[model samples]
Target chain A: MQATPALTVEHLTKRFGGRVAVDDVSFTVAAGEVFGFLGPNGAGKTTTVRMLGTLISPTSGSAIVAGLPLSPANGVAIRQQIAVMPEAPGLYLRLTVTENLEFFAGLYRIRDRARIPAALEAVGLQGRATDLCGNLSKGLRQRVALARALLNDPAVLFLDEPTSGLDPVASREVHGLIDGLRERGVTVFLTTHRLEEAERLCDRVAILNTTLRTIGRTDDLRDRLFRKRLLVETRAPLTDPGSVFDGSPGVTGWEANGSGVYEIVVTDAKLAAPDVARALVAAGADVLSLAEQRHSLEDVYLELISEDVEATR
Target chain B: MSGERIRAVVQKELRDFRRNRFLVGTMAVLPLVFLVSPMITLLQIPASTPVSVIHHAVGGSSLLLFVVPAVIPPIMAAYSVIGERDQGTLEPFLTTPIEREELLLAKAIAVFLPSVTVAYGIYFAFALTIRFAAAHAVSAAVWHTPQIVAQLVFTPLIATWAVWVGIAMSVRARDVRVAQQLATLASLPAIGITALITFRVVTPSVRLAVALAVVLLVIDIRAWRFVSKLFDRERLITGSRAKPS
Candidate 1:
């Protein structure tokens, strides 16, 4: 893909009367990037998506999505390049799945009537196409909605909490579908409360609280904020092998279980682990097992949110 | 603006209307009852009265003429618009290529056309009743160029007004039930007029009714324009405060 950002927000601001939802927020999403927008609810994630999708106009700033300006007149053009899946399933419940597809196909200005059949097949709704939308299960309805969003073969896809209320199986199906989209070079902007979703799907993430808190590669962001903690299990415990080099570096905290195992939390591991082993040997404790606990993405996410909340207060 | 697109939209609406057999039944029953009830009532009128009762019933026909077209069309149009909305607004055409305006307009027509058909059927039935009443009892029906003009010209204008009301309410209201209630509420003026005619509280004058029709025509044009503004898609999906201007 090219180097240019597929989506750009310049000095973006959205104010709802007295309160500002998105305040001077600016970010860029690179071409074909799975850009994750992680924010607590009511952090203007949905607002920003609506503006970028051209559903709502921005209060002050401007956004260029798929190389098209976001304006009502340019709605069709912008919409042609991006598909938006709102928080709810905005569908025609009365129409059968086939009829619903036919309707949206016309809306997208797709003339070939036959593509409708293929589109239904793409979502694995070929059999249910004849069924009324109201009769379908919530998971099935969400699939139909995703199918409609894909009608135009858009370059950018906006999914607003795509799996928020779905069962695990359905959520996995959706995640798999999104993963396939990444392979197909489609840029995805997703707003999700599930931090794991952002961790798994996003190449880069921007944590938004009141404004853009921080934006970067997920691993980089996590490392920049919190030190990596690892969980390791050794075959046997270390029995007082320390005092060989008591002041060793990178290892701050160490504890041992009574069995042939030891639990270790290290900060400066270069000096600490070696000396701790020697000290354990001198103390006559057998080095049977060792283990380190690894910090998770959730740990980083919670840390960031807490930091932001603290800063706001 | 595309013919193909417009045709597609119209077809979707027709599909909805066809599926709503309850609405179809109401359209048939209302028109048939209104048309046949007056004739049946007239047939029972004393046969001993002069056959010239045809001329006398002209007054009744004039009153019925205004009442039938003015009252029924608006309420019927409203009901139809609201009825389609019953399936949760999104449940119907969110996926359709048709613009919201075109969809609303087409639905308005769906509501209007059936209403006019029922009203016209009532008029035709009344006319037939007048013929039968005159030959068998009193020649109460008055045949005049003006009466035909009233039915052909003014009745259509009235139907258009009703369609506008239904469309306006349909777009403004969130669901079918609310739209139907609001549309039904809109016909209060016609109902008030009908009550006046029945009570003889207001004189049965054709000129006043025609004047009301003229005023309604102007308001109808303005309402149509205003209604389209409500279909502001941005405000519909995004909260109104979302847009800058």
Candidate 2:
């Protein structure tokens, strides 16, 4: 039997006055999967997270978080099972790091006295446990917030722009921490503007723009949205690379580089690479190398967002 | 209501309250004046003074006692939710498992305890000062009369009413300054009515004291209900969007 999904959001929406912030957004996160929610500013990423986290009630539709259905009666239970680290670190600046964690542990009713220290250690904040959150730097404050979020050992975690405004080293530290959470079978629902971070950590991602545009595995999205490309290098200049690709079944178009290189858009690079190489050699051009080019998640994201904008317009 | 969560929020608010110099100064300085100034003025009155003068002096001191509970709660409770929002702490706090009523009550109690305590403490200090300093002139029965009932019964009720009003404003007002101003304004009606009784502008009788306490209690209940209803988690989060990022 398949395991139950940790979170299921169906047709969730939120409206502020007459303006709809999140419109009919829907998705599900499986147990222990790192699911990324990506969108531009004002695209309802935070709104959707807020609804799932039980911070705000949905204007319409429903969701189930950690087996508890999202409703007014189940808000407390849903909050108990999931933790959200908002876009801001949102730590008590005056309280010490240990105090902050202990306070939340108490709120979570985590009776284990050792859990406070364990949470601190989990976030690598044991050394700064006694330091005032106000005295700590931005990155350290984020760590404290993470420690607080882990106080309950929640089944599902919501991290919104976790690494935003962090230096490279601090961002890496957070990435490493998230990696550790995934290894421990924690379901992480992450919202971020950084495509690279999502591409690196998320098992699958859902691109949202007030509504969900697409949801699938990262590589799968790239495959579905972008065509394959193959680069061919020859020992001599391709005087007429178009001639080689003209009648090719799989080749859609070709562009010649200055000297011995040519870039070809193909229906399937894996299937077309060998054929193109054979055709180049047959055409009396010595084929130096043939390689396939993979598109990045950023490309797919930009392509989707621009398409969304154009369609809306 | 979860007792543990309420306790945690109360503890954290208290810890933060300690760090605020302005609030601490107001809590300390204002009560000091109200408590000590009455004693000083009572001490200056000669023992040879008439009974009417002594009664008038005690009545005047009782008015100062009313001021403590009225003023302190607004200063503290007004800052509770809005202060957290200003400090960028409310968002994470609301995401926790703690219920909304638990969070609001914990904050209200955190402000309520110190405000009422200081008020009553000052009243106790004033009574002691009057007993020791004006021993020959003022009778102990004067202190033990309706003023004691006012301190024990009416002060807390009024303080609670003020706190609930402050919390209501804290929930509705986006700016902490605006919340504080509104709370201060809300405390006026209660304080004004109490002042009338203390100054003999309204008759000081046990029945009047009981009647005032009952009325304040009713208002306190309504204020609590209003605060609980006004504090919308969505509004608090979305309202901050209008603030300069």
Candidate 3:
């Protein structure tokens, strides 16, 4: 059976003055998938995210979020099904955190006030429910925003720069909260400049610099950057380790150090690791640290964005 | 508007209004200083009015009447959209299932309720003072007219107009203070008319009052329709069009 899409954006276009913020962007996010949007500053990620959350309407394109059309005509309906945590803190500072939750839960029409405690618990803010939102630390404020979004038990979540200004520990807490949303089958659409964040949370990502430069699974991007290379070490010296692999396949970029430690770049290390191991044994070298090394998502992210500038230039 | 949706929206708006002690107190204070302070002086005039005393009293009274309707609403107008925008509650409130009007309805109530109520309260206190001034000496019809109007019809209508103009200013201006200034100016024309009438330039009569109220009502109708259009959630959020690079 085919999976249903949680979001469908087609030819999404938004203009600010004569500048195109988001131009002809089209993509579909499947239900329960964590879709990451990576971009440089001013790359229109927030604009796109805002449009999806129904906080703002598009100039001339269509979006279907949670199977409802996203437009001024149907904004209320679309908003009912989606949770949006904008980059900035959005809450009532005067009201205590619990009051803020109760106010929103009331808007969402949750009859009993008891449910607010549960919502607060989810964000680990139950203990601080009575504290004023304004006086809380930045991370606590972020969680309050998150808890407010989750009040409606939305079908899709749009979190824009959720961990942008957080300390490392706070960032981890927020990251964990976001990761926890997956268990409820909420479709999460996120935007971040941090490549590691995208790698850790997103199932797939699109690198956007003014427009999409490249998009795919993280490993697929890794492959485009470097060949599959594994490290193997042996005794002090080995002469011509590759001399045994006369019939081995796909070792195009071959380089082996003279310390009986060999490294051969292969397209697929699974097939090549065993062949290289057999050859190393034949060469009387004991195998050690036979681990595969891969390129980090950060390297791939930079490589993709810079390539766009180069191509445009 | 669906009943549940309206309630949901109203409950939230009222909740926010209740949460805002500063706005409530500020709304109450602006009118006290502007309207009640003047009304107290008007009630101080003797019933056996000296020619000079009546002239100054009547002139100031009419100006207060004009401003009572025009000026206070504009002040109230600042509280409409600017408060919501400044508070960062605009998007969340605007996106709810509640119809825009329901939200505005509550906001209208929020602005008008305090302005009109305080005006009436001041009128009530001023009325007792006027009655004391009359019983202690003499009473005149005009001396009590402003409070009666403030109580019966003029205050409510003025509050409505104030809220209407306020909604527009709040939507159009970038911030609450600016909106407050702009919306407060909505009463200028009323003040001008009162000035013309006060100088024996034009007599204040039933016909004049009705005509002026009719014109105001008509302008307010157009303003009502126009202000709702400005209440667009999209514009309030990203602001006006962005400059393209």
Best-performing candidate as measured by DockQ: 2
lDDT per residue as tens, model 3, B1-245? 54455455445555566667776676566656765665566666656667656655656664564455566667656766777778767766655555666666666765666566666776565556555653233235445453244235556666677778788888878878888887777646545644654544566565666676677668667766777777766678878742222
List, residue by residue over B81-102, the lDDT tens digit for candidate 1: 4444354344224323345566
Candidate 1 per-residue lDDT, tens place, A110-172, comes to 887777777677778888989988899878888887887777787788988888889988888
Give one digit per residue, the lDDT tens place, for model 2 in A117-197. Answer: 888899898899899998999898888888888888889999999999999999999999999999888899999989999
True contacts kept of each: 0.32, 0.74, 0.35
Model 1 interface Cα RMSD in Å: 3.7
Worst 10 residues of 2 chain B by lDDT: B236-245
Predicted structure with the largest TM-score when compared to the true one: 2
Please state the CAPRI-style docking class of candidate 2.
Answer: medium
Name the runs in model 1 displaced over 4 angstroms. Answer: A232-293, A311-313, B21-33, B45-104, B121-145, B173-178, B187-222, B238-245
Candidate 2: lDDT of A225? 85
CA deviation > 4 Å runs, candidate 3: A109-114, A233-237, A244-250, A256-263, A286-288, B2-25, B35-40, B50-59, B62-73, B133-139, B142-147, B191-218, B242-245
Per residue, candidate 3 scores C-alpha lDDT tens digits across A1-313 of 1287998888888887677788888888888988999899999998898778776667787889999987667777887788788787677787789878876775666777777887789989888988988799989999998888888888888888999999999999998998898766778888999888999999888877656667788998888776788777776656665475545675656666666666767768888878777776777776776767768888888788778779879
How should the candidates be ordered by lDDT, best one leading? Answer: 2, 3, 1
DockQ of each: 0.33, 0.52, 0.38
- Candidate ordering by DockQ (highest first): 2, 3, 1
